[model samples]
Target: MPRKAAQVSEADKHAAEGGAVAVDRALFLLRAFRLGDTALTLAELAQRSGLYKSTLLRLLASLEHARLVVRHADGRYGLGPEVARLHAVYAASFSLETAVMPVLRQLVQDTRESAAFHVEQGEHRLCLYRVDSPQPVRDHARAGDLLPRNRGAGGRVLRAFAGARGQLYDTIRREGVATLVGDRVPDIAGVSAPVFGPGGELRGALTLTCPASRYRPDFRTDVLRAARALTETLGGSFPFDD
Candidate 1:
């Protein structure tokens, strides 16, 4: 069967790329209910999700049954109590300890390099969390280390998203990642991407560091994906290049 043609929202694009079309589309609907939205009608959902009314209704039925949505007497819908329950569950465990460590670990596992979360600290950057490479040869930075803010991939990301104007900053803001070689310490290279907070504010930079001899340009993709994951986990929207 041919898929119907319609305008695709960024969330919808994410859903399509995620491979599980039905589940992602259902999530696409839930996400359509934004802040200050108490309720949404069928047409509103259809308009936002880019799904036909029939498909939307089916998804809504499943969502309603799962207590993820509620149908009002006015034929409108609102999020159900389960969402609050889930939020409570998430809130109880949401922290850098629970949220960031796993991503850093996986990043190290993927690239066989070091991964760290860097935050802007006045004139410098703080390594808030780090996972070292399994390889014997690597940089020796650890968590809580204060690194330079004027150079390095992580610093560039912090400066770029914070609106530092220049060609280098422009590229980082546009691509949502920064890859640099020997910007700080000699023989060190890194790729970093911005992680956003709940209000879409720049929270920190997700960085992957390796010896210049082993740095791969492809590290940018891993860094960006890790940053995007962390952004969404922190309740921020991960905006993509359109």
Candidate 2:
């Protein structure tokens, strides 16, 4: 679950940063442009950034010189070509494993259980990446193994986000997670949460599994945290939060 953020102004945060206050404030101004905003007038920028026009103009001048922001003939500001170049470079260099492995490894360490990333493959779910528990006893699943979509916590998460309807699926949808004992295999329990990629797509499910007798309900938090971290890394947002 997401914790409530303490009320803090951007100016306050910039001040709290002992060094590079100007740089932080300039970045904050850039962030004032939201999705669907093509261009912002000086007054609009001021309204959004809560900064004085003098400060903004000076920052905007520096940003324009760096090709990070552009001013139109109408005196409106828009993101510049350099931003696209940076995005292209980032997108070209990104790797799925780089974004996912660390989260799964951390989840395993935190829960002391097996962790896996599962993706829907037609009528089945594929275990794309997995980290085994340190303990000797654990489920025998591995990376590249395909499991049924009709069973298991990971499959249920995929189905729930894919519009499956039922009481259990409804609960999973509401809670942003699914937990089941003996769902996929006898005496095996699992907790799973959905991970997303860019454009709000359901990328996969991050799951933790252990013997039913040893399963702890608190593992749900670990699963949720791992899922959220991976989702953010993939440039997707998880809407469920406290």
Candidate 3:
């Protein structure tokens, strides 16, 4: 008896599907670091990436040897310096800053509050650009500040709209907008929204921070509107489900 051509083709198709699944699992391991944690234990990584412990250990060993992941003295793992170098290479090749600078400045001017642009930096979020309010008593945020993704309004905004699922991400996503009543600084309030790029990928967040006393009932609406306007200007798309 001879096998049919369809049977051979189906076998080949199954092999290809299996390969793809493996690749997806590997990528999921890398993505586990993006949840704003500085480091994760093996068990935590397994739970987050949905990989079996045995599989994750093998993958982590390979990644660690390749300098993509590093194991800390405490037996936790985090992205290695090599990953930062790679990000620097990619950032140098692209110009997200050039594209969004004018919009950020406009947002600050229109809102009369401090505005900043933040992007995910390994296990944290980094403020890449910021504009201070003209008010003498205004809050100030500086560029190059690394913030925990769960901390403030800007961080929550990025986590929420980016479809992240940790406690911080879940709470913000459920709320639609992030509001901070002094999470970052005493007496300072902030609001933020996620900025998406092509293919609905999270690019960063556009945020406004001010004194808590200045926030009114309409502040959230204003921030949302500004974020939407910026999204349109940049030809960015977001998930309709969010």
Tens-digit per-residue lDDT, 42-121, candidate 3:
98886676555676788888788889899999999999888889978866776666667777777777778788888888
TM-score of 1: 0.78
Residue 120 deviation, candidate 1, in Å? 2.3
Q: Tell me the spans in candidate 2 whose CA falls farther than 4 Å from its real position.
A: 1-8, 11-19
* Higher-TM-score candidate of 1 and 2: 2
Question: Over 4 Å off in model 1, which ranges?
Answer: 1-28, 36-38, 52-76, 80-82
Summarize candidate 2's per-residue lDDT along 121-149 as a digit string, tens digits. Answer: 98999999999999998998999999999
The estimated TM-scores of all candidates read: 0.78, 0.86, 0.55
> Candidate 2, which ten residues in sequence have the lowest lDDT sum?
3-12
Question: Which of the two, 1 or 3, has more TM-score?
Answer: 1
Report the CA-based lDDT of candidate 3 relative to the real structure: 0.73
**All models: lDDT?**
0.89, 0.89, 0.73
Where's the lowest-lDDT run of ten residues in candidate 3? 5-14
In model 2, state the lDDT of residue 22.
80
Q: Pairs clashing in candidate 2? A: none
Candidates arranged by lDDT, highest first: 2, 1, 3
